[model samples]
Target chain A: MTEKELLKQLNKLRTINAEADFKAANRQMLLAQITQGEEVKSLGYLAQLNIFMSRLFQPYAIAIMIALFFVASGAYGLTISRQAKPGDSLYLAKKLSERTKMLVAFDEKTKARLNLEFASNRVLEMNLLKQDNNQSSAKETLKNDFKNEINQAKSRLAKNQPEAKSDKTNDFKTAGSVKDNDHIDVAVPDKKVATTTNQGAGIGEVLEEAQKLFDTGAYDQAADKLNEANKLVK
Target chain B: MTAKPQTDKSSNKSDRNIFLSLKKYQDKEAFMQAYDLYFDQIFRFIFFKIGNREDAQDLASATFLRCWGYVQEGKLKSEQEYKSLRSFLYKIARNLTIDYYRQARPQASLEEAEEIAADFNPGLIEAETSIEVEFITAKLKELKSEYRNILVLKYVNDLTISEIAPILGKTKGNVRVTLYRALEALKNLTRDHDGEGITKTIK
Candidate 1:
């Protein structure tokens, strides 16, 4: 016979399939055996969970998950640190977090604004310490730190004055938005208000003048006005 | 003429995924699907090997049970072994068939008759079987076990050489050469029996 005819005849043997009744019966028996075997040696939920965890989270994956948890909790703690006083444990973290925020600011104006807000916060912290009867030395140190932060804010604003002057419409827009600092209302009025009429100016009015000076590119003068507003809080 | 089986990439991928589900999760559904898919082919394969229907049926069932036992014990090693479920099942059936022979005849050493069983039990060929089938099966029995197995896997099971290689633990080139030789041997056997009207009956 030719190979083709032989191959055709060989292919015909494929018809020797398993009988239907035998297949169905054997399948049922096999499944029952498997089910019994599974039950006999079944791992409990905890063991299965362990296996699942082991498969899903390799060493690197577990490490990544732990790192993400710390980051998330740290963020939550830092938010609470916003209220931290100078003597509190989270106080340093609060300062470092603020510094990080300032460094990440996209523009000099935003950085200067953040520094000014930080300077106000330091003065606010000092007042709270005084009320709590904290040491005089701590207040003096806070006063020095506040002065340094105000100076940095002034320098940053002065550095960006040329850009501010070029964008006249944006400068006016900045002056108009000065009232957005409604949240910065903790600054105490200066006791010298009875002696100097200008001292009678509210912190809001002093900030408004600062914004006007900024619009005119007199950034150092604007910074002096904000510094005056901060000193009055003490 | 070459008996080449078509390779379906998608189907192979799906089968591998099902096997993985069985391996990792011990998924009964996946195992059932595998059993349904290969039960007939495995039965036919065992039937060809042992030449007995009742024994073939029992061994085929045992094959799946043994496979599940391996899965439960995580005995199947390496990624390549898991790639083709059909090849893996055939490999198991082939080994079991050898063991069946070794047990059936303790007098003849398994090493001596590992490929060819001493007695093929031609009477056990299915009742109501056609003359062509009986003739081919009897002729196939005369050939050595290697030739018979290669022919059955290639033609009866429609497995490609690539699929057959891993099951037989032979190289693709070796399987191809053996397959050629097997077909030649079968053709020679038919030509020698031409006068007996066997070739005429087949035609």
Candidate 2:
């Protein structure tokens, strides 16, 4: 038969009368399942059977799978929770736990020299204070104080620099140069380093603060806190 | 229907079967009424699709599975809203056949291609018998699955492109392209096998 002729015949046969048997089967099954008010297991029962079979044949495998699942899920859940929770601020803590490694790739020795040079004025002011207490004007006193702090900060920065490479657990002193005064953006080591440095203490603390900020709807503040946390171990 | 504004004669036949199915499913009398109305036309349609008594038996069995679902369940309302129950179930049968192929896999070989091309005679098959079905079914087997499927769904099953798109998981445009391509391929394969003369007589 040609395609056209065959198609004509097929169309003629497309809507045959319904058979008695099919109606009985469909009606019985649908009624049986729907009245139960629960799932009709007959459809997907075969799939569930396979899962059970694996458990019986591989007891140890199942046990290990369960244990691993718990451990992995617990760890993932904790990590997600930490990500979800806003951390307590570095500003709030006042004492930052920054690793020293970030001091590397320093702009050049010139940056350090300039830093020290700028810091000297404060040192000179403190020295003058001992010679003639009131003789140093307020501006001079302020400069002197600032200079001493700058020098002290520089020295602290330099000594910590060597250890920063070998050990990533050094304190906030590594975040040298008062980064916009009072508030310092400390660099935390990578999670690898942070785990070694002070992972137990800091992660819990930082996570808690950031979580608090997030909960309060202070998204900007929460972000700032997280960045500071990242910097602490950078 | 209060006033079926459908002016198309095709829609009238289409509309009537739909109405019958709805009435039959709605009430037992309606069920018997619809069966009497469409039984001959629908049987002929299915017998043509499978092209053999036994498989047509199976296809017809499946067709009623849908029809019964329509009746007792009240899922489909009045047939006039639709083209007709026959069109609706034919759509189902086409899908069911494709799904049967996917499920059956290696079991469902393209049977027509095995026949010899030489001494091929479209005229040899008797005009009103299973002989013609075997020949055409053989030629049908020669077409690619996509073309064969569309040809079956559109021409063999008498479905609109609109009705077939959702069932085949395709756009209407895609269905048209596939249908035309399938027809062309079937035509070419027929020409190659039976000569261009065969294509003219069969079509």
Candidate 3:
């Protein structure tokens, strides 16, 4: 047969539309499964009996339940809080978790990193607030918080001078890192900022500039410089 | 011949919007809409490829479930990525079918294909058409797997060359060439089955 004739004969097969009863049933079942929320209700009578027996152990059971609750809530909160912004309800939860992480962190390096991350989040929150223009007072508070967090991070980095030195050369090797630091430094100007804005410069320069600005009562400018420094350190 | 269902363009767009909503917000209503939109088309595609009703249904359901997992993972974030959902579903179905074949070699028989075709269009297949279908199916089994896949995707499932490319991970030009060669091979294989050959009477 000619190729054209063969193509026409093949096209005839398109008419066959097989019906599978299970297809619809399976789809319904799957959709039902996807839409269904976890049965957070009870595990029924056995679970209730177990809980009642555990409650007889009083303090131990209470401690275990509290631990489980916090762990579960922390996991759920972390997952949902990723999308939260400054004024979001979950934003506070995100911040609380960050604080918890810092408290639990063993090394000064990790603490410094977490502080810088928190300060960065505060900058993002300020940016969002600036865009919304909803709460000048809240923006001011976040700006101050951003400054405080950066100062704390700067202190932490200062305490770990040797590790910070190694990190400066090793961690900030990429052009992207240098570019990011330069971008932040250029956005906010202060003598203290100038001290820390240099590539491979430690947190000492940042703290000095921030302290000078704070002493002069230029709080807003101090906050801006610290925010810029926070971005560099991160 | 039974008339093919007309694809509604607006509904397709709405289905896409629903998919995006499901991906971004985990909206159950949107997911249900998406499930309703593509379920049958995916099942038909799998059924044709696997040539078994039960496995096809299971694989098709698994395909959607896997897609839902991707949506939750935020892998399909953009509209461009979501627009490739059909090809993505087909790819999953294709992989699952391959796995099924690996577990049980030569699982899809001509008789199974005939049975499925008969199940779909019970009254439409007369003795002559049934014999013709059997001959075509028998010859299809003889072709290389790639050739058979292209033929079934093009003819049975009515996927365009463009749509078939991503599922097979080939360029559009490659799909076109493979499809042409596949038709040629099928024709050659079926040549002796009829005195006039399968394609002679066609215009």
Candidate 4:
């Protein structure tokens, strides 16, 4: 206890002991006696602990983060890799068909000379039913050589385009309207059978109905109908 | 102040006078410097307690002679150890006087000693004014062998409870409690003389 706290006890005994010489010294001496070296102990422990922690986890933690960064970056890169976009497939198909790299090499006004484009490959009979029958042998040859096969391939491709496209109608609808004449090329070449069968009452009929709604000042309803028209057209 | 001289003499404390600063007297040149400092304290304390000039001189001379040996041996290190050695040596001087009593007046009781102590205040001539220290030291000397050793180890030698425990072959807890009881006994003795400040004095 401090001297003040123990003062009452000291006071009571004071009168008695005063007649006699006595020392009542307290913590003053002891506190002086005990040697406390400056905070070197804590400093030592902290230095050791810091070194220990870094040594324990440094390698594994760095490795894990590097691995995670690589994994996420790989996934993100995979997600964004380029794919064929709208009308692109059709464009590709058309270009592929035209390059003489394809089967057909004829121009519209062809008086067939040796088609130097196809001349390297030999064929005996270049036959055809002539257009204006009296034209000539060379003309007939160009006409016959590629006309049948090219038309057949084109028709087959046109049919395949619609079927292939039908499955992706939702994707096409979300991506926005096919642009200008490209729209016709993308849709019409593919949907010949559907258009011939539906007459005008398929996608076109829905668009007409939506247009009527728009004219009547029901724009919201008109937009809804337009979306349905998009679905049908796709 | 005639008392029996202690027969057995195999301790470091017995070799120096309590009031002497052994550190000051530690050099060959300083031998007389130490002799001058402590000679009177040993003489008066021994003479007054034993009530005889001859034996007191003998004990006093013996105290200084042993101090001289300790100094010559170069065992006096610091002020603290020197102080400890001095106080420890005083206990030796006191025990020597007690042994003198044992041999010369074997029939005398300790009560006779206390009666002597009642008139035995050292007045202004002694080293310390604190009667509580003197009283406690006297009582500690009278305590049972183990308890007395622990008491002296605690207060006089200023050893830690941990340090004392091993010395006594007791657990630290046992040492602590024993030291406490010994202290309480000292406290009671102090209260009889001076009621307050005993606790503070020891500390």
Best by TM-score: 1
Error of 2 at A119 (Å): 99
Local lDDT at A84 for model 1: 74
Label model 4 with its docking quality class. incorrect
Worst 10 residues of 1 chain B by lDDT: B3-12
State the lDDT at A4 in candidate 2. Answer: 52
Candidate 2 C-alpha lDDT tens digits along A52-102: 353344423444345334333333332222122112121111101011111
TM-score of chain B of 2: 0.57
TM per candidate: 0.51, 0.34, 0.43, 0.24
Which one wins by TM-score: 1 or 4?
A: 1
Q: Rate the local accuracy (lDDT) of all candidates.
A: 0.66, 0.42, 0.57, 0.38
Off by over 4 Å in 3: A2-5, A15-20, A37-234, B1-19, B77-83, B102-129, B192-203
For candidate 1, give the lDDT.
0.66
lDDT of 4 by residue, B7-84 (tens): 222222222322232344332212332333334544544544544444555555455444444555665444443334
Maximum-lDDT candidate: 1
List DockQ, one per candidate, in order: 0.16, 0.06, 0.11, 0.00
CA error at residue B29 for candidate 3, angstroms: 3.9
Pairwise DockQ winner, candidates 2 and 4 = 2
TM-score order, best first, reads 1, 3, 2, 4
Report lDDT (Cα) of residue B7, candidate 2. Answer: 31
By DockQ: ranked, best first: 1, 3, 2, 4
TM-score of candidate 3 against the unseen true structure: 0.43
